[model samples]
Target: MTERIVVVAAALYDGDRLLAARRSAPPELAGRWELPGGKVERGETPEQALSRELLEELGVAAEVVERVPGEWPLKPPYVLQAWRARLLPDSPDPKPLQDHDELRWLTPDELWDVNWLDQDVEAVREAAFRGAGNCATSPNAPAPAPRQNPPNS
Candidate 1:
């Protein structure tokens, strides 16, 4: 598969709960879970793409925290950069607006509970869990720690 530089956000609300999006029907990993963001269009700043994505996919605009810097450490082709964003209190009800089917709030303990995009698995391990479920209610969800590979001879 072609890996591309995607800009996703580990969006959170009330400071502790993360926002996860459920993919639409018949997705490669349909009914699976993922953070609410997407690929960074050319010429668009990672920050801009993230903000635009949230609106396009979830129907809400959020303030970019500009915390995490640089692209996430993934193999070439699938280069990605993301940030921690805070949803405004005035945020709209985030119903799935595009490829997504639903939205949810999950804690660290619950993050690894579902199948995530191959690239996003590591992010969940790194991002700290802030709060418990406040809105998570879907068909399902879990995290597997990264495995270390033995050095080749």
Candidate 2:
């Protein structure tokens, strides 16, 4: 079986807002919004690849906060994964230096306003929850808790 191509997407957050970018190249995906990222190279870890991609595509230094907790399948031979990322404190504001033509920082209430690439919807939803402080639907709903590892033996 062919090895699946590994790709990474960054749900870049600035406090309660998440970043989204508009694709500018590749006729099929152009005009659709997606989290900024690119393929992981053979020798690089996903985090390294994501950092490199963010630098190359958005012109900023980023630090991966955490993986978004799921794997998403793309077209055959490709699988996409997501991570929470943030710009370094001293890094310049991100710009669309490649891949994308526009960038927007979206508040949680504005998450559904953009036309996202279909494959990205679920990942975006999860990222939105993280940004919105674990938005619980009902007052009685249990508040979301951060994952904790079992106590050391």
Highest-scoring model, TM-score: 2
lDDT, candidate 1, residue 113?
54
**How far in Å is the alpha carbon of 146 misplaced in model 1?**
12
lDDT of 1 by residue, 20-76 (tens): 777775546566666777778888987888888888888887887754433565556
- Hey, what RMSD does candidate 1 come out at? 9.1
Sequence-dependent TM-score of model 1: 0.71
TM-score list, all predictions: 0.71, 0.86
- For each candidate in turn, give its C-alpha RMSD to the true structure in angstroms: 9.1, 10.5
List runs of model 2 lying over 4 Å from the truth: 132-153
> Which TM-score value belongs to model 2?
0.86
lDDT of each: 0.63, 0.81
> How far is 52's C-alpha from truth in model 1 (Å)?
0.4
